[model samples]
Target: MRVIDPRPLPPGVLAAFLDLLGPERAAEVRAAAVRIARGLDGGTLWHVNSTPRGGGVAEMLHVLVPLYRALGVPCRWAVVDGDERFFDTTKKLGNLAYGSTEPADRLGAGAADDYLAHLELEAAQLAGVLGPRDVLLLHDHQTAGLVPALSAKVAAVHWRCHVGVDTPTEGSAAAWAIMAPLLDRADGVVFSVAHHVPAELAGHRVAVVPPVIWPFAPKNEPLPDDATRVLLDRAGLGSGPVPGNVVADGPRDPDAPLAVQVSRWDRLKDMHGVLTAFAESVPDAHLALVGPDPAAIPDDVDQAHWFATCLDAWRALPLPTRERIRLVCLPMDDLDDNARLVNAVQRAADVVVQKSLAEGFGLTVAEAMWKSRAVVGSAVGGIAAQIDHGRTGLLLDDPHDLAGFADLVTAVTGGAVDGTALGDRAHEDVRRRYLPDGDVLATAGLLTWEIT
Candidate 1:
């Protein structure tokens, strides 16, 4: 197990929320966080998860840990070490949970042994340092196995699953076969949606918490018009003159509209679907599919395969249209730089899209919406819960409906749907419903419940 500093050197997560949440709400939030800190008589609140980079789980911890620390809580973050097999199995479970049709993968007895062995070793190492006064928080499936091992070591343990399939699927059943037993160790388990609570977990106390974006994070922060050019050019993802915004680092009409999606290079994100849809219907609009370099994210073994598949799809498009579409991998060596580049890309967009086949609440939607960019995404999982259909943002009835997606794209890019109006609604909705304050309060409540 490796203990690392929170990446991107968080810029006061609690303070960052002050402006967005305002004085009263901000003060109330501060009091809640402070209450947790003061209530912790002599123990630390420990957070455990997989990689501290690349995905949403990591992004949320990065935001939450700093805020809790500033509030005077002794919050610590540790990334569990795992072998490739461990990651691959976890990925299989995740894919199955997401309803991947590719023949469901299962963790066999030997594979299950391999998974437990690694977690046990890490748990032993962690147990040496933990005291009975400490509260252990195991995040997602990656750290779920450590629950039983650490149960006797810590004062309380809470397990939170950041990924879930709203609708039942065979893949989910297969994955849960290996995972359900681990939930037995959780004092309480948290999820992003109620529908994700499986039959085995029907009796456990479950809290459906929405994932939120810290507006101050490098990736979602506001960039000046000029910074957009410099950061975009620096990251090599895209470039533009002071006036053109970004044309994916290639020459294109200054007036041409742009639609973008920033997500991990995972099949579930549907980068290929976005590419094919753009090439076929929204030829007039430029598209950008941006994510962290696969080389930097050690856990995502499927990244290279997915990237190649998308690239192959991109090559199938007409030569002239190739210049209008960009398949980008931003450098992760510099977290701040990576975030600023993402911020520029999102802010430069006329519309943002997240056409995921499955999701645990698309924070990308909220990030883009916070930037006041209209979003068109599938009405599945948490995405449906975020956007109020036609009012805040557009949603597709069927995720596989590429033609309908194209029509939505055309509507946003054309003068028909008011992008600004939709963005306004989305931004406002996000402010009221999804924020770090809510997430913090929920965590505090959960911890308090377990302690009581």
Candidate 2:
């Protein structure tokens, strides 16, 4: 087996691609990323997931596969396709996986049967593109069914589960049963956190690999102050006084506190709960709800009804209170700009909020912390794992604790709590633990170990 070295890549070719971090931390992550890339120099890695756009899995792979090839590995990424019926079924399966009892009758009965059939068809279509000995990595539940179909030809198959899997309910169990055979067919399973691995797969060749943020990547890095100004202007937020600044600019008065929520507008993300908390908590603070309109919800469904309810909730507020809340629904195609805007918001805001009822490792939390911003997240799933509470960041148990959340927000923004210190610690924590280069390297190590 060839042991590829990560060094010797020309300067500026690949280094320019990573998100920016503190100098020492950036060097450490770069070295680790290079090492991981080098390990698979002659290996071919295939990553398959649902949807080519609009979600974290696809976004991560978009940047990740290229980094692999640049570092000398042969890599390819493919999206699994299905019609509206297929997606609707799979979407319910996702909710069930997170402990929802929603019946996936469409997905569970004939739709699931058809989905598997589609996978078999997809497998045949991909046969020519995939090398017989390539390491096939299937991501999430959508593509999990593909395993049994492709098992015979691949060198090793690894199922990467990105969500939490505590004690699953009956609905989840049924979905798992349909998917279990495919999982059992794989050489091993990879989970973002140890607790997320289903008990049945616990004793198998399981690897606990956390998702990582590529610091040098466009979406994750800090923009120049000028670029930040441009983004704020475009967002209609006008040049306001940034939290630490002496002068107040347009709508963003530097003296007032700024609180931000960056997540998909999905019910699982608990955007409604976030609004409720903010409404009761700090009326003086400027709140921005930022993210592309969620793609998970079907278009024909009453998505508009939900949005209207949220809008009505905000509008029903007294005039003064309503003015303080700004709900921004971003376009899905503008993810890069959205990411940069998020970085800018982190820099400008005094407190960052992620009140998710359920989450798959909440990369936005990591991204906020990376920007040296203090975060108050829900104590569910990986959010608890990411925050150290009163140290790196705060974790709220009852996301509806309006008063408590407000107090924390005021404490941090009022200079009573050291927001800067918290952000600084968060940056160090993410750099040491969650950088993407390290994740890829660790993944490569696991794959190599399994295959060899």
**Candidate 1 segments whose C-alpha is farther than 4 A from its true place:** 7-16, 235-249, 450-452
How many clashes in candidate 1? Answer: 0
Question: What TM-score would every model get versus the actual structure?
Answer: 0.93, 0.85
Evaluate model 1: give its TM-score. 0.93
Give the per-residue lDDT digits (tens) of candidate 1, residues 388-410: 88899999988889999999988
lDDT of 2: 0.69
Q: How well does candidate 1 score on lDDT at residue 57? A: 77
Worst 10 residues of 1 by lDDT: 240-249
Which residue pairs in candidate 2 have backbone atoms (N, alpha carbon, C) closer than 3 angstroms, thus clashing? 18-216, 18-217, 19-215, 19-216, 19-217
* TM-score for candidate 2, residues paired by index: 0.85
Clashing pairs in 1: none
CA lDDT scores, all candidates in order: 0.80, 0.69
